[model samples]
Target: MSEREDFVRRFGGVFEHSPWVAERAFDRAASVGLTAGNVHSALCNAFRAASPAERRAVLRAHPDLAGKLALAGKLTAASTVEQASAGLDRLSPEEHQRFTELNAAYMKKFGFPFIIAVKGLTKEDILAAFERRIDNSPEEEFETACAQVEQIARLRLRSMLPGEDNA
Candidate 1:
């Protein structure tokens, strides 16, 4: 495979199950270039160019933090590690139940799973965010989820490609 193909395949999961983000970035990289410096921005642009439905699909690709999929070990490798970093994997039963309740309520209210960039956050921090965000209007929460997805993509890209900072 070509380097661009390799790049896309390797970085595809940076946006959960959405490989289109990587593919779109690679298409731009072909004309310009791919570097640790600019790859995240390219991907973000690709995400931005996506249609509303497509963007929603990308958001839907992400599993809820500490949701059933995480508990069942069904999340992608990147998601598993990200959630674990927030100590989600070691939740107390009561905390787990709380997360479960919150997850369901948030999804019911917003029509999508709640997302957070959990890498640097404590579980308490995540829970606090969840509580506060649940009160947001659906439109506000959707925008928040999109921004968090971008944050997650940047973090995942950094892990796969060294020397990257948020851009």
Candidate 2:
């Protein structure tokens, strides 16, 4: 595979199932030069510039927090690690039920899963966020989901891209 192919393969999951984000970023930067310094910016731009439907699909690609995928051991490697970091992997029966209920309600309300960057948050924080965000209007929730997805992607990219800060 060429360098661009490798870039996509490696960074594709930076936006969950959206490898096109990396592809567009790589192409845009190719016209200039895709250096380590600018790759992150390019990827962010590509994500931000995606069509609304593409952005929604990217948001929908995320699994629900502490939901079935994590229970079934089916989360992607990055998701598994992030969920575990938030102690979402160790919920009690009651906690798990609460998460299940909230996940369903949030999706019903917004037409997409509730997404938060689970890396720095505790389970309590995650739960509280769910409660608070559930009351948001659909438009508000959609924008919030988009922002959270951006945060998740940035954190994942920082780990994947060497010489990149967590900023």
Candidate 3:
């Protein structure tokens, strides 16, 4: 089989179980020229061989909200924040005002959105992280951002490939 095919077969195992996610994964892989079966297999092998922490780190390295005009290299960062804040319309007016203020301050302080992977996290957990992280120094916040990016990427990978050895 070709490298891409192998990649699709192996790493794709995670995604294949979820066809919608698989399609998106395939599109992403293809965009990066892992379109060949063998190449894909190699990529999958590499991803699978990584330690769980390493995988998480890789995910975190991405810029949040990849394509957003405001985020620049921080697309994933923006998207994660947006996703986490999705239900904020349910908040009271005061709560909404506080969130907006917090978000603005976070951006002003960190030069990026406060980001955390929302998958598997409760809304309260997300809110807490946002509040707590705002107190971090720029250097500390940068590292925290990096960590969050990895977490988000790992979560995306896991969602894309469920049954595979995520480690």
Q: Largest TM-score belongs to which candidate?
A: 1
lDDT per residue for candidate 1 within 1-120, as digits (tens), equals 988779778778778798888888887755666665477778888999999888889888889889889878898888888899899999999999999999999988988899999988
> Which parts of model 3 have CA positions greater than 4 angstroms off?
1-89
lDDT of 2 by residue, 51-126 (tens): 8899899989999999988899999999999999999999999999999999999888788899999888999999
Reference-based lDDT, residue 11, model 2: 79
True-structure lDDT of candidate 3 = 0.51
Better of 1 and 3 by lDDT: 1
Off by over 4 Å in 2: 30-37
Worst 10 residues of 1 by lDDT: 28-37
Model 2 weakest 10-residue run by lDDT: 32-41
TM-score of 1: 0.93
Model 3: number of clashes? 29
The Cα local distance difference test for each model comes to 0.85, 0.86, 0.51
lDDT of each residue in 2-79, candidate 3, tens digit only: 754564554443321222223335545655553334234434445545565544444433433212322333333434
